[model samples]
Target chain A: MAPIKNGRHLFNEVPVGYPVPGKTTVYDESETIDLETVPLNGGILIKALSFSIDPYMRGKMRAPTKKSYSPPYAIGEPLNNHAVGLVLRSENPSFKAGDHVWAFLPFQEYVVQTNVAHVKLLENKENIPWSNYVGAAGMPGQTAYLGWKIFSKAKKGETVFVTTGAGPVGSIVAQLAKLGGLKVIASAGSDEKVEFMKKIGVDVAFNYKTTDTVKVLEEHGPIDIYWDNVGGATLEAALDAANPYARFIECGMISQYNQTSPYGVKNLMNIVGKRLSINGFIVSDHMTPENAKDFYDTIPAMIAKGELVFLEDKKYGLDKVGEAILDVQSGKNHGKSVIVVAEE
Target chain B: MAPIKNGRHLFNEVPVGYPVPGKTTVYDESETIDLETVPLNGGILIKALSFSIDPYMRGKMRAPTKKSYSPPYAIGEPLNNHAVGLVLRSENPSFKAGDHVWAFLPFQEYVVQTNVAHVKLLENKENIPWSNYVGAAGMPGQTAYLGWKIFSKAKKGETVFVTTGAGPVGSIVAQLAKLGGLKVIASAGSDEKVEFMKKIGVDVAFNYKTTDTVKVLEEHGPIDIYWDNVGGATLEAALDAANPYARFIECGMISQYNQTSPYGVKNLMNIVGKRLSINGFIVSDHMTPENAKDFYDTIPAMIAKGELVFLEDKKYGLDKVGEAILDVQSGKNHGKSVIVVAEE
Candidate 1:
């Protein structure tokens, strides 16, 4: 085939605060690749289908010297995240042409995968939307499933307070808690998101921006579990309203990610008096083969059977990746933000 | 028997900040009780021996409307705490005259107990000092033991950082962590206390007042477990120095107990990145019959065998109760502060 236009989003510069589009990240479509002859080195060549834009990616856009759970993105390199792609050509037996696969892929139109260690072949027998694989049935989905399964330890009739309830991970966690016989109190930034939370069967859904978090919790809670996605004031509120021995699952703190100075949580002393258990976890750590298998066998089937659902805020084309990430960081995106790089 | 002088410390007023020595706690000695004629009411009339003065008592000095794990002290009532006493007379079958017992007794020269639910018959086969029951072999010891045993999940070759390392609970936790084959890094306010920490087998002991806590932890740690006794800046430092999956046993937060505004912990975001598990507990909650039996069987024997040791800062008379509590609240007492009310 002739050389074709290949678009990519490159990490341009590390930002002091919230990343600036076109400055922190540069969209480059000047590059070209010969689809039929790109070097694979016994690996597969993939055409990017969709990319998951998440708040955690902001943590990666830091100075390389700063240590975190995820490594910093190298300046001038393609920003990478969870992406679903089509295997165009393959030399590896595990993947073949026309097979859909999910892997940590760079934000680029085409990828030449020399190492296949992080790649997993996608099996969509029920034919769910390709974007769902990057959102609901993908990393975020597994994050909610594994985190809830391993940590929440939810008992029937217990109350769970979930922050960022309309977001990918929180939505799933809230649904799981609701289905598992828990009284779910969830919060989101917007009234629309709050309505979405109510639609999803949340017992008490509120717009955190308008409501006093502590008062709401005091009136409706003494939450047995706290699924914390937006940390800061909500966390302090949760602590105030938590029942004795409440379990706090620290998944993400999207609110503080872009701040130059993180929020100072005051009432941490409640941890001692209430005998609260606060656990912080990175979901990728629990993605063992057994756990992944269990997640795939259950969550997708639930989605297919209409028992579980997820909302996607889709941004068409690679050019929208910067805006999508910023939206996720600022809580502007109402659901799992995804950049649909190409149609299947 | 003739009437005897019975002195006690009474809760006089609730203060906003630190409990005042004479104003918040008043020394009352006007009332005298006849040792022979005092009504037992199916309980026991006891002569108070030694009382444990701890920082936790500061929390009980709040308004009655405020809820806490421990009930707030009633105004104009005698202050109560862990005490080792001798039964002067007994109407209950469980106790006999002259039998030593450990119970939650008022800080008084003499006490009349109607309910024996909180009392435990003291069996000192080795005849350890009566004061030790109110310090080393008592609640503080059990607090250290059970908190360490149940929450720490410590493994050999791991590192543990303990704050308030010379205090009753932290000292025992430090020693226990040291003996458990973990690298123990402990901090104390004074140089003398740091020396005591070293003597008790802490691998690295520092005076937190003189040395920067975060610097010391960074140099000696990546702590696997944090036995948090002083929970303000030190807790934040521990979070910064913690290894992935660090277990924090939130035994106490003495530093924040008296502060009107609790410290705003800025680094709780580290909880998620490091995958930390912080568990707060009240030792009394875990004191089931089985656990209490295990603790009594093991800890006392350990003290007797010289496998465990504790320091006691003894206040000679019941008049010193107010000062003792003040000293404990301010972290002025080097060891387990106890007011010796009477001789056994």
Candidate 2:
């Protein structure tokens, strides 16, 4: 073990409505950390390679609260998310040095993971890039798969409407729905993102910023299912467009995530007449053995066969993390936003 | 059969926000009609004894649109609902004169039913009143039974929150939940209604007008299940008060039915973190033979044992129908609002 210079950003204070520019800060050289400690029993010491920046992180940035699904980042501590890394040292018998692992870790150059369950060695059998573990084919892809498979129960010949269709989870959901013989309608913030959704074989793609969701649905509904990633107005539109016995899968409310006062969903009365079912879920709850097996077996095959496509908006270094988060929060990214912490 | 003077009320026009005084009009010197005229071979001529005035009629009063669950009342046609009657004449082999039957008919003194399926012979076991068919022991009772049996799946020792607790459907839902060994919390519009809910074995009851729903929930929350008969603010509070994996049975949105613009539920983001499932259904969709059998076999037994109680606010004649509707809409009725169109 030896002292190593570790540069990292830490969460300073809770944001009011949106993250302030100084909410996250990269330390000066004088504050560099020493990575001299050995990993605890069943633990691995790793160098961070890449990190995911998602809309859900905005909820965590609020003053630490128990109401959030995941634990909030402690003030003055580095924020954490799904990350891909290279193992520099291992105190666990199951893993060794040079192992490429995936774990829930912070945005730091190096770290010691004491929980073995949170860490997994990456298997690159098809020569897939390591960063894919943090984007599609990883947490996001599995999430899309499980939500579609379990919640939506999308059937062949059925029509589906997906909001935030260009984001990591929504994009995967659209592709999976298309592959399942469903007619897919997708909505995104920007025209570029809308084009990307159409490129991925969505039956209909619209820029929600320019197009009225209810108007689009008036022509195309009554939709059989609505895969909701962005709630609020989009959800109200979906509620209006839904057919009898329609299923609404609530995955994320990115539309309301940063608002000081979240939008109230009107037209919920339609639920009764339409016999609608709105179910909300977190990805971690659906990571069963069967779902994991299906995710690992089916998704990569779809990718290799060109039947599925995923986009990654990657920034060059850890210093760009805060800006990357801002880009995601503002819906500037066309796909999964990731920060490349170090070169492989 | 001879011509008889028949007095009835007809739907004149759709209401803008709430029904105006003349939204429905009673006939001045009603037309006399011959009962001999039969539209179809299988027909039963009946005298309407009693009719139900329910909240769902508000939707029917909207500008006749195909979007609503039930068909709108034709501008000049008599409004229809569940009514008990005496069969005056019959050409159908399934019925005979002097038989008491229930059917979806109008508020007139008499009518002809060509469809046998829409009418059922009433069973008077344990000397249950015939009008009870339109109240606690009939459609509303069956609805409460099925919603709880299918949606809530409430376990003993769990807690349930019911909105509109003094209404026919809401009252039954609270009692059923209590009988199933769950602590029941109910909300109503008036102090008298709150007292009624408490008398019906509700563990906690509140007047929603004076007490803030969210504040009440903040004290007694993390509720297990919310049986929503009144949506809007109460639904928002339920969303906030929901514990992990809470189920919300969407029965009715009485508060929003008449509004030109419905209330927007604000705390929907909590659905994702809490993993809540909000489901809606029309009772007709769930009236299986098994459910009907259970309702007939169990509910009457509970009533006989004094384990269940139901109230009916019965107006004397069809002339009182409009006032009864307004009472139900304004949350003034202490129980199920019904019109005794003819004396027993």
Candidate 3:
């Protein structure tokens, strides 16, 4: 512990726009967190074994209380994500020192915890990699399942369309839709991603770079459900292709982040003709801790049954966090980018 | 019967567009529909009575097809609407000869019916005016009600915003929202229509022609539900002001109809942040004979109590039919325009 040194690194504030590499200075402690060394009843401290860098974190960099579908992260606090860690100390009966767990923990080296309500205790399984804890067995996987299963209300023999079909959330979404008996169609930015989708159960996957989205979609008529990750043009194409009474689940919009450029949609009138139903979501906004179980349980079971495909683009360490995020931002990541902060 | 003499004069082929009025010769029938000479079918024969003209008939006029939302008027056939008529004969138990009925009938001298399924019998409604069968008491009323009530899933004390607020469908939607204990905000193209909305329960009304839709709606804070009868830019403004999980019941897009032009919505990415839902519908899409009961029961009672406002901008005589159609197309009708084919 840095208690003897009188100085330790803690996260200072939420960043906006492009954060300069390594300029984010972590301080000794944040004002809100109670790091009382005396262990409180049923409380523990966890040293993070694995950390995640996700696109959802980008949503949290604004004012904490923006009344949007997603709540913003607070300023001047250590960032936290779905992290798997080893319990270093515990007063909690369920957790002991050295027991492995996946808790919503900060991007810091250590997390002090109490009331392990949102934390899921992890048992080491040799066949499953630890990075998957922040991906397939964590939030993104659950998002893929719920967004496809409930949001789309996907029907058999219907076509399911998705944007960013190679990313963590959308790739899994397409896989789950395929398992649910729907024909899967997807759009990805690169040729590699398009082919990746085909290998993973997509019926039709088009490279947006070479293909006119509307033309490609028209070739595959009557999309019944659309699971959207890239918004703007792709979403417009989805709208244009939607049959009457289509359901559009807006899981993420990688297209509409910080920029001087405008977000314009030319085909909104299609929503009226098609009687489409679209909804935006931050999975955490609607999914509670118990619901998180529903997300994890179904997908892992699906994978165990050989009914789902899962992929992760893992970056070696915390040093590559910027590169990992940049890959997602540049539409280069084939799937979810996981930060292997400290290899288990 | 003079069918052998002037069969061509009685019916017309469908004209392609506005430059050519219709495909039949304008040979005048010197003799009009006569009650004494016409052979009436025993099942039911509706004497040409008052019928309702609606905005959506423009869509029908474009092309008669299975692909379209509604079947277009057939070539060489009289135009149809919500007609209120006197039944001269009926073999069906639901009606008898000389019974007054409200049904879907054409703009002809008399309509012979072998069956009467999609119809309502007018037994003792001598107290209410016959045209009321086509206005607040008819399809337009049902369009507004079912579109907002059932589709939008609108909740009381929440905000309901509608475009084209003073028109028959939008106007009644505003009233129904008000009755449901919601705050009603509406927009109309003209200052007079704004005044009309203000007169009938609209809490806030704007002349969209004069005001910036985005600015006006932002002033109203977040909109919980948008009942969009006029899409395009007004729908865009609604999208920006929509709260998370907002429902947009898209009943019509009259703003885009006259165009050799298509209007583009520029801010549709707000669907991701706001999580808005848009559904297009014809009141026909939701109507079951059972759901029709809510309209048939509540409307007469609402009219009797003077809680519902009904307006008609009538053009007198059969010759005025062409001008009336043109006027309604121009969006110049102050309210529902009916042609008086016979004396009341």
Candidate 4:
């Protein structure tokens, strides 16, 4: 066994609005150490297979503040994210060579995972692809599942309006609502994404960039539930279109995230007359182990049976991590954005 | 009997921002009639005792549109409100002469109640004063009761922030929250109201006119529940200071009701990260007969035991209805504003 070089992406500076490529630079730090030389301390050495790029990461790129849901990514430190990896070595004996695992790890070619709490060994009994863990069957999928179960609870036969229907969490939410017998209305930024939404069984899908969302909602909705992903004008549109006793699930406010001054929602008075309930939540706080089990027990089976479809916009190599994040931020990703760092 | 000349206030025009004195005018509509000449049509002829002037009436004074919680007052008709009265003559079998009743009747010296459904025979069995029915024991009391039961549901020991702490609905909500074992923090426009709140067992009371509500909240809270009466900047302040899983009860937005442009709520993004729930409700919709029973069963007893105190800002004469409404709007009323149409 010989020493191997590891490539990682480090957070260099706090971003003002949208993060650029220069904010983070690719760094390759080489050290020669194999599995045999690794000390046993309930940790595992692994090669990163794939990582997820999500809108929430943008919150972390801001200057370190207590207000954000997650801690700010420290400058000069490797940006960590949900990733799938192959465990080359394990000191704890719970994991071994060639074992596929999922953990919150950085954008690095190779790494030693010391926190046994975050690292979980994958069963792979059904031979589900490793990259799927970072996209569909992982955090995003769990997020979609719990969001419906806890926040929105958009009932069967009710009309649901979802924003950013092409994004990771929103797309999953839209599809699940469809599967649960809801009348799914979705909005996307591009015609291609609208078409994709339509293909995914959305009852009505519109390109928000080219259409007035309020008009679209008025035509297609008296929405019973609004699953908010992009929360500026779309939120106001939803407020205008909400029916009596409507429920609004506040997921992410991607539209307001980059702006210095957030869009002031003006139609909140409707909440009074219409008896609307607006609830915001972070999936990380709500998703328990039991919830994860419930998700894994049903969703993966549905995926294998073709009853559920998950799309991943795959980007290859560690160097493309910055670009992948920008794609998510700009709503350019066709579906869940994934950076494939290494081949299985 | 000689022709009983009746003086009543009529809604003359749609108010733009706030209802002015001239938007409604007192009219003397004299008609020759007697108790025997009153046609038997399930109705009761009554002499008015007292009637309420509420903040919600401001919303009704707006242009005739379907957007508000209630219908706009018909321009030429007398303005109707919750009133306590003495039944002078009765054609309906349910009511008889000398019986005291409460009904949604016009602001007049005398009236014939044709609609039997909206009238309820007063059961002042506890020897409760009839004028009290027009204030704390009536609509405003019911509004406060239902607001807490359905919307806020502030748990025992949780800190609850209430706006308009000296007004009708808010004052009752604050008192009830205290009785329910909550730490009550309240805001009022005047220092006198602040003192009133402090006297009513509020843990902390601040004059919002002189203080920053957000700063007050930051000092005393990570508020678990916010019972909003005055919306706008105070509502925005509540949003900023809400704790995780906080509940916001949107009872009224009196602050924005008269504004040409509503204040934009800017901190709504916090709803997601903090997992806060904001629910708006119309008390009329939630106050069912069963709810009224629950309220009457407990609240009246609490009042009798000196455990509860209700303040009434009573003005004499039907001609003063407009002035009373203005007082409620300007936050000049010490408590629930009531017009004594005639002496009981």
Find the candidate with the highest TM-score and give its number: 1
Winner of 1 and 3 under TM-score: 1
Runs in model 4 with CA error above 4 Å?
Answer: A24-33, A124-126, B24-33
Write model 4 residue lDDT over A21-85, tens digit each, in one string.
75554444644456567665778888899998988898888767556668888888889899999
Error of 3 at A58 (Å): 3.5
| lDDT measured at residue A148 in model 2 versus the true structure, 0 to 100 | 87
TM-scores, each model vs. reference? 0.98, 0.96, 0.87, 0.95
What TM-score number comes out for model 3? 0.87
Give a tens-digit lDDT track for model 2, residues B216-238. Answer: 88887779999988888888888
For model 1 the local lDDT of residue B50 reads 92
Clashing pairs in 1: none
- Computed on alpha carbons, the lDDT of every model, listed in order, comes to 0.90, 0.83, 0.71, 0.83
Identify the runs in model 1 with alpha carbons over 4 angstroms from their true place: none
Tens-place lDDT per residue, model 2, A1-344, is 45656767677777766675555544323344445564356677888999998888888876655557788878887878999999877888888888898888887888878887868777766667788888787888888888888888788999999988989999999988888899998999998998899899999999988998899898877799999888888898899899999999998888887888889888899889888998999988988778777787877667667777889999977677778878888899878898898868
**What lDDT, from 0 to 1, does candidate 3 have?**
0.71
DockQ, per-model, please? 0.87, 0.82, 0.55, 0.77
- Which of the two candidates, 1 or 4, achieves a greater TM-score against the reference? 1
Model 4 Cα lDDT, one tens digit per residue, B1-344: 65656778888887777677755544446544555566647788988899999988887876676566688888878888899999988878999988988888876777788887878888877777788787678888888888888767578889999899878788888999998899999999899999989999999999988998878999999799999887888888998888888999987888988888988887788888888888888877866789878887877676677676878899988778888888888888998898987776
Docking class of 2: high
Return the lDDT, model 2, position B330. Answer: 83
Note the residue pairs that clash in candidate 4.
A3-A32
> Quality of candidate 1's docking, in CAPRI categories?
high
Ranking by TM-score: 1, 2, 4, 3
Model 1 per-residue lDDT tens digits across residues A1-344: 89999999999999878888888998999899999988889999999999999888998999988899999999999999999999999999999999999999999999899899999988987678888888879999998999999999899999999998999999999999989999999999999999999999999999989999999999999899999988888898999998898999999888888888888888887899999999999988999999999988988888888888779999898888888878888889988999998888
Worst 10 residues of 2 chain B by lDDT: B20-29
